[model samples]
Target: MQIAIDGPAGAGKSTIAKQIAKTLNITYLDTGAMYRAITKGVIDRKIDFADQKAIAQYAASAVITFKGQRVFLDGEEVTEGIRTPEVSEHTSEVAPIPEVRKVLVQQQQRIAEGTDVIMDGRDIGSTVLPNADYKFYLDAAVSERAKRRYEELQEKGGLNGKTLTDIEADIARRDYNDSHRAVDPLVCCDDAVRIDTTHMTIPEVVACVIDHVEDGTAK
Candidate 1:
């Protein structure tokens, strides 16, 4: 069984998807991290974003490995490295490249084959896992989402000294980039269940998702 959760930045897709994966006893795949790894590689190689061919080639050739919560690119641990604000900004630029998404989507599919997995990202339900057993689109008001992101960054030790307003602005920019990307842009599939998480707590959201999974809403 494959489960897909997709949404804009700060919508709690990652946190909620993790809990859902745990409840379903399946592997949790963070597809966004995969793109970030590729972006980090491209940046490290000093490749210009204007060189689409080079960026695509870099993504295709890069070796990305995941061990539990740890992420490695080209055999180097980059779980936290990819979270840098720089990587975050560059990832949005590269992720929409057709060739880049092609390579990463293929890798993501390979990881889900013959296994029960819950994958979350901006385009999972719309592109990566369109036929997943259960599909969910998590959403929240921009303000609420930004607040959640700010709190999360605070918990992660100030997120490189970024202010809440800075994070909120970043989230807004990401939302636009994700939704307007030319290839496989972020969108909720018609069959997906949309969950407005603006006022819902983590446990409440998880319970709601699990309830749908337990019932016949998604099969």
Candidate 2:
């Protein structure tokens, strides 16, 4: 069975999906990280994000790994490289490309083969795993999301000296792109259980999801 979690940036998809996957004894795949990895590839290869052919070509040949919670790109252990401020900016540019999303979707589907899996991203509920047994759409207010992202970047110390204002602006810009993309845009599936996490804690959010699942209303 595959449980898909779809949400915007900083809506707790990664943390929540990981927790739920652990409880259900399933493998957790962070699809957003894959896009981020590809974004990093664009940076390394100097491919123009708007050039669909160029981005698609790089994505087609990209290698990504998840050793538990760690992410790697190619032969190098880019677990940290892909999450840099630079990748954060270019990932939105890369994520909306039709060809790039198609390639990543195929890779994501392949990872769910023969395993109980939980995958999270902007379009998982709508595009990647439309038939997922359990679908969740997590969200938070824009200001709240901006705050969460700001704090997270502060903790990671990966902002590369960028200001909090810069981070917030970048996240907001990505939000617009994600919601308006022509292919596999960010949308909450009607059947997906929506959880507004603006004022909720991690454990509280996880419990709500668990309760919903146990009651068969999560989808």
User: Worst 10-residue stretch by lDDT in candidate 2?
Assistant: 158-167
Q: What alpha-carbon RMSD in Å does predicted model 2 have with respect to the real structure?
A: 1.4
How large is the C-alpha RMSD of every model relative to the true structure?
Answer: 1.4, 1.4
What TM-score fits each model?
0.94, 0.94
Model 1: per-residue lDDT, tens digit, 93-168?
8988999999999999999999999999988887888789999999999889888877877777757878778878
Q: Which ten residues in a row have the lowest lDDT in candidate 1?
A: 149-158
Give the alpha carbon lDDT tens digit for every residue of 1-219 in model 2.
878899889899999989988887889998988999888878888777668898898889988888988888886677788778788877888888888898999999988878889999999988888889899999998788888888888898766777767767877888888999999999999999899999999999999988888888875
Which residue pairs collide, candidate 1? none
- Clash numbers, per candidate: 0, 1
> What C-alpha lDDT do the candidate models reach, one value each?
0.89, 0.87
